[model samples]
Target: MTDSTAPRGGKRERLVTSAGERLHRKGVAATTLADIAQAADVPVGNVYYYFKTKDDLVRAVLEAQVDQVEAMLASFETLPQPVDRLKALVRRWDEMRDVIARYGCPFGTLASELDRRDDGLDLEAAGPIRRILEWAEIQIRQLGQPDARELAITLFAGVQGGALLAGALRDPNLMSGQVRHLERWIDTVAASSTQS
Candidate 1:
């Protein structure tokens, strides 16, 4: 087991961080504890000390992703204008176009893969997406959209679609184009809100 007194950000942190990255790049089924152990530079046997089972580690990864989603949404809350905040969200993805082109959106890809399974873990993996939808809905509602929930789904769907195409086609431009379109769409929504 990991030492309880181990310094902060020790082996356990490394394992979780490495596993998250590997699990994103490699599908959950394809990622073995051995792979994570090697990536984290922890001994294969020691992996079991920290994570009793693969499922345990997977849950940890899901929790980390959820935390990241919460942080991203909280950061947007700091912006003064709802439209600008939404634009910044789009721009964040645009900035990651190269990475998305290579690996797709980390959360999107993982959720898509896990969603195909009948196992209950899929629901756990999807928590981050659900949180994101809720956050987006709040942002859209702030723009005075009556169908905020539906619009939020559409907005995120566009982003996910862009990531899928960008990864499949190995084209960052596709992601960038989607980001630009989203920015324009946000502007249109904001303008419509003011006129009504």
Candidate 2:
């Protein structure tokens, strides 16, 4: 018999996608298998067939997030100039200001929540953010910044801080403002590189 829970893709894929979205909105500890099943339109018992445990599902979600971050970074690389690439990244965030204001940065909020749990997957949960930071470092390095790594950290922190504040205040403008400031900072850094 064909499974009703299965979508055009597959039940497992749907479950993972549902879990990731729920986890982003509800967090790891709070999101239950039942919630994922409901979101995916699958039976609760069928969830166990795909993921033996909640941790297993969480790992899958993190892997999906890593893939998303890689794809985003790859898209940024298509830009001709490093500064333009970084600006593209900022613009990307600015475009998501509404979502960020509602739920904050998925990776940042998830990492913070998982870190607080002191669970073994804390590092795993942080993998996506780390990759983003490393990608930013490479972009900054391409711009010939002597402190590429430090500047990347600053950029990541600024984005995360803006995400946190925007979510707290429910203000999309706050995130847009931060994105504009970051774009200006990128220009300043680029100019300094030329002068030095």
Candidate 2 similarity to native, TM-score:
0.93
lDDT tens digits, residue span 1-196, model 1: 6577343558887888999999888878899888999999999998888888888888888888898988988898889988888888878889999999998998899888888877788788789889988888888899998988998898889999999999999999999999999999988888888435
lDDT of 2 by residue, 1-196 (tens): 6575444559888998999899888888788899999999999998888888889888888898999998998988778999998888778778988988998888888888888766688879789999988888988888888899999999888898999999999999999999999999999889878434
lDDT of each: 0.87, 0.87
TM-score of each: 0.93, 0.93
- What residue runs in model 1 are displaced by over 4 Å at the alpha carbon? 1-9, 194-196
| Deviation (Å) of 7 in candidate 2 | 10
Model 1 weakest 10-residue run by lDDT: 1-10
